[model samples]
Target chain A: MVDPTESPATGSSIRHEDHGDDLRTVRLAGRLDMLGMEPIALKFTSLTASHAQQVLVDLREVSFLASIGIRSIVSSARALESKGGRMALLVAPGSTVEATLTSTGISEVIPIHTEEAEALAGLGAAG
Target chain B: MAALTPADELHIQPDPETLRTASLWLAERCRQRSVPQELIDRLDLCLNEVLANLIDHAGPGVLEIPVELVLDPGDRRGGTPLSLRVRDGGAPFDPTAAPSPTAPTVLAETGIGGLGLVMVRRFCDEMHYRRVNDFNELTLLLAWPQETPDR
Candidate 1:
């Protein structure tokens, strides 16, 4: 769990790790609402703005995900997709990740799974 | 015939903390009324987005708004019309009349600086606007929040 004490101004935290060739993983937690969506958007924009080719957003620790947060994710995904890259969201069990994915109608466009491993594997295979 | 309905006005700074707290409190108020999930969902979204925009554009000032909640048996469907009137002492602008982004516009795709009022108008039943005494009154009405059936 990302300590709320040290979280960003939006009260959302970002943790990224390089998975494989041009693949990136980013973890997000805490309430991702309007105020929180700001930093999240910047973080994502910066991450996909780099030389990275693929980005996977991990929301396993996210407590709440709002439309603004969804917009950030979709924006980042579109940016990557424009470059022939891919964006995937890793959602944990009982998380509203499925609804967020469905709300944006991105589930059909992107891949989501119950576990990070499953989501990463799906993305790895898709990529 | 007389009924007991509660209506009150609140004044608070447009600070983000105050705005979020007020909206969250309003959500709790809706829950206490046992509003259905559907109504609650809309209220939750509208409350946050509306207030966020209010504080952002309205700048730092006292938000003089009236919140009127009525629990009426007028509708047999167990839904009561919810009225939320937000009057701000800010610049003269009506968001309801704002034009929506053009279809699939590449600009809208960025999704960084748009879609707040659009979503509210899309989800709410009716939004009334009036400017009086140098105050912008935004009367928002939504389909009644589902209430519990009389036992």
Candidate 2:
């Protein structure tokens, strides 16, 4: 498990948890806006896309989301897809984060799960 | 009970860094006016998108002028009507008229371009844009179901 400190300016934080068997989970919290994306973007990419490993981004604690943050997630997810890896997002059901992702139609490209078991199951099936 | 009551207004520079300030100010004003939390969240989201676009695409000329934000609350009726108006002296861009992008089925083909405007349109009930006296004035209007509890 890799724990990174939170950004004071944007109140965003990211941490990585290894579930063994080459599966990792990146838990993101706080706003995912223009400023919020700044602190965790590099770390998020390094943990998920750079290694080409299965990743489940947990966004249940995220209170706000914007298109810029969505762009970052899509960019990283695309990178992972290119490298033979898969990524899914875990968002709270009926949340603004979920609504935001749904509005962008990102669920078609990247699976968004409200349950962790479902998200992990989907990622596991991809391997 | 005028058609629209102007509750508050905020003036911000067209700077990316100042978007948060505008968002917080809007949220606080919404709360003070007993607006529902869900409506406040929607307003905050669209405000960020709109202000960010002004800073990014409106050019350096926008930096010289202040972006004006007004919160207009409608008469409490079937639902609470909330209208946010943003005015800036930048390039005349009408987000309301911008063509919405087709839904993407693949990650590689999905471009984040124009998605912000898509979000703004989705979150708000009505979007109106007009160029008046060399200023681009965009208004995002939304309302919540009356059953929603004020927070």
Candidate 3:
């Protein structure tokens, strides 16, 4: 379910999805540029880094992504991994978000799945 | 690098606050020209990275100077049809000369630094930097993917 609290200024929104058994999904919508990141950056970091063990960041709805947004996800994923947790991304196969992730070689470090079930399954594996 | 008339130029101070304004201006210009959506996205990404670098690293004194942006839809004859030229009084920093960071193989090795330049390189077809009349000018070019003729 989508969260009601959306950031209108930057047109970015972040919501949490609990799938039971320590699995959760953070759905991000709107552009992930400097403005887009402001409203969701802190919440995204807190949810993925401090709380969830196996988190899936669904970026299917993210229209635009800048390096700043990528930085947020990478750093949070690193933090989550340090705490014995794992983070994966769900990106539309041929979307701009996917292109950016792959171009930066983020797909190599963090598993990116086009399908939600596959993403969750990948997160379930031992890191 | 053709000079942009006053009508085609956007001027904004080097404040992070103006980033959105700059982006929207570029988007609006591209939409008016009917530039392809993919090219527009590429322009927006590269523009942000270039501006962010100027705002964060171009030193405090440079903030007083306004950054200038000019979008040029070059001849559609195929070789780099679209280009955006960004002019600022910031110190000379050539993004094309900057080394792209190696992609991290693991989260432990990942760092946020230099990723912006990396994206700038990947998205832009060509990057040209020049110090023009004391202003650091960067021209980022993007080309439409060639459509294969019926085989």
Instruction: Give the winner by DockQ.
Output: 3
Candidate models: Cα lDDT each: 0.63, 0.85, 0.84
The candidate with the higher TM-score, 2 or 3, is 2
TM-score: model 2 vs. ground truth: 0.93
Which number leads on TM-score? 2
> Regarding DockQ, does 1 or 2 come out ahead?
2
- Give lDDT tens digits, candidate 2, residues B1-151: 4645566888888565688888888888888778888888888999999887776687756678988898887766745567899999988899888899989998889887888998999899899999999999998889756565669
Candidate 1's residue-wise lDDT over B35-142, tens digit each?
Answer: 565665565566566667766666444454432222221232544466667766766778778876433324225444545665566556888788878777777777
Q: What is the lDDT of candidate 2?
A: 0.85
The per-candidate count of clashes, in order, stands at 1, 0, 0
lDDT of 1: 0.63
- As a whole number from 0 to 100, the lDDT of residue B134 in candidate 1 is 75
Q: Any residue pairs clashing in model 2, and if so which?
A: none
Docking class of 1: acceptable
Off by over 4 Å in 2: B1-5, B78-80, B147-151
Locate the minimum summed-lDDT window of 10 residues in model 1 chain B: B67-76
- List model 3 lDDT by residue over B7-111, tens digit each: 368989856568888888989988876678888888899999888888778887898898888887764444446878999998778777888787798788898
Put down candidate 2 lDDT per residue, A10-108, tens digits, no spaces: 888998788886798999999888888887888888888986678999999999988888888899999998998999999999999999999889988
lDDT of 1 by residue, A1-127 (tens): 2222235555678768887677778778877777666655676677755553767787888866666776677677776777778877778764444554554445655566667777677777767
As a whole number from 0 to 100, the lDDT of residue B8 in candidate 1 is 39
